[model samples]
Target: MTEGAVPLISARGISKSFAGVEVLRDVDLDLMRGEIHALLGENGAGKSTFAKILAGVHRPTRGSLALNGQPVEIADPRAAQKLGITLIHQEPISFPDLSVAENLVLGRAEDGWWSSVPWSEMTREARKYMDLLGVRIDVTKPMRGLSIADQQMVEIARALVSDSRLIIMDEPTAPLTPKEVETLFGIARRLRDEGRTIIFISHRLEEVRAICDRVTIFRDGNKISTETIDKVSDADIIRLMIGRPLKEYMHKLNTSIGEVALEVQGLTLPGVFNDISFSVRRGEIVGLGGLVGAGRTDVARAIFGVAPAESGTVKVHGKAV
Candidate 1:
């Protein structure tokens, strides 16, 4: 961003509440043009709330917004879209029955209710944007059958089709493969080169460092710091996020595993998961590690009888549960 130039989006004293409970306090941020700005925060840190406010999902309880030095009120999502802003959620909210091309153009003004459907044009446009992102998918395919990564690509293509000046991506790479994430980063860089600003909300520090120019850290409903990415190391960013030194927050102690406290044998959840077996000792903390939708949560739920496995034997202290 050039010195003394007006920001593309200026947020001042932004605050939000829900049902009398405050979730975001007074915060100010300035988003520059043609830059990938990262919003870093843990869960419930008000970063999402701030992004939603910019996307028109939530209104600030006490604040003012300015676009290019002009005051504006984002009444809703449509209003935000009109101002060249769009938010792509963590989970791609798309119509399962709709074709990929139709979903891409859904809610777009050009696809008017009174006009005849333009299947060929929409498919061509969708294909063009997907190609720009280096993704090749059948635009005629139903959205229900697409993978999470592909669906996210479609959402990004839609943003491009809308000519959104400022796009907010919320955890976009969570469900993506490493190769898919690479493609996304390339597309983001291309968009930035084209003078479109992006607000990337992510938990991964490495990703923020790789693709972002500047980062804003949020904690406990407040903005902690905003600095050039090169100026802050991973430890520095982590310290700011947790409000402490990294060593203090993470302390590892050697310990011996005791006798088995719980055991699972041949746990199965139909097509979801099969033949999952594990044992947890009394003094062990086993992490179910994997990416999103990797059945980690399902395994925990099944072991606790929240969602009983279709076929499995669980024993607690050598007794069947």
Candidate 2:
């Protein structure tokens, strides 16, 4: 940020509570105009809560918010949209049965109650924004079977339709392939160059360093630090986020081995997961670690019967389930 440049959005002494449990306390943040500011924190941190307040999904329990140096009351999602603020959720929200064009202009429709929707005009306008994002898709197709990447593009186009100035993207790259992530990054940079402010939330540290200009760290519902991305190393950010050194968290544990408590044999979900076998013994702690979309959740789901395996045997306490 330039010296003395006023913030586009300023959060002062903000706090939030749910059912008498405080989630955020006296948090202060400033988002500069036309910059991609990354919000970093572990699970259960107040990062999402703070972003909700900005997007009008939740109101602050205390403190105030200012836009362009003027105080504003963001009552709801509609109010946020009217204020040129839009939030694209981690899971893209759209009407599954509706066509892409209809989903794009659904909420911000210009026609009156009795006025007929001009499909030709709406499709033309929707195509314009999609083109701006360099995405090509059939606007007449239902949104149900579209890929996650395509769904995300539709959400971005919705923001453009509303003439949004500030867009908050919550874990936008979680479900995307590596190539799709690069494409999304390019679109984000283009948005920034066009003078739009973006609040980027992600757990991927490398992605943060690759695309964001500044970052804010959150821990236990408190604002820890905000710094330029280039000035802070990845290890420093991880320490701040977890409140400990990485080595300390990675220290090995010493324990006695015991009889097997759970076992899996020949678990297969075809393309999802195949030939997986593992066992967990009593008095032993085991971890299933993998990158996103690596079928970790699928394996768990199969074990739990959420999705049954085609060929597998799960034994619990020496008895097959």
Please report the candidate that would top TM-score against the real structure.
1
Candidate 2, residues 19-120, lDDT tens digits: the string is 999999999999988899999999878999999999999999999999989999898988898888999987799999988988887747644421366888
Q: Compose the digit string of candidate 1's lDDT tens values, residues 1-321.
A: 799989999999999999999989989999999899999988999999999999999999999999999999998999998898989988899999989988887747654731455778878877888888778999999999988888888888888878899999998998888998998899899989988999999999989999999999999999999999999899999999999998899988898889999999999999788999999998998888877778999999999899999998999999999
lDDT (Cα atoms) of all candidates against the true structure: 0.90, 0.90
- TM-score of candidate 2 on Cα atoms, chains taken together: 0.89
TM-score of 1: 0.92
Off by over 4 Å in 2: 110-115, 256-260, 266-299, 306-311
Per-residue error (Å), model 1, residue 53 = 1.0
The window of 10 residues in a row where model 2 has the poorest summed lDDT is 107-116
RMSD of 2: 2.8
Which residue pairs clash within candidate 2? Answer: none
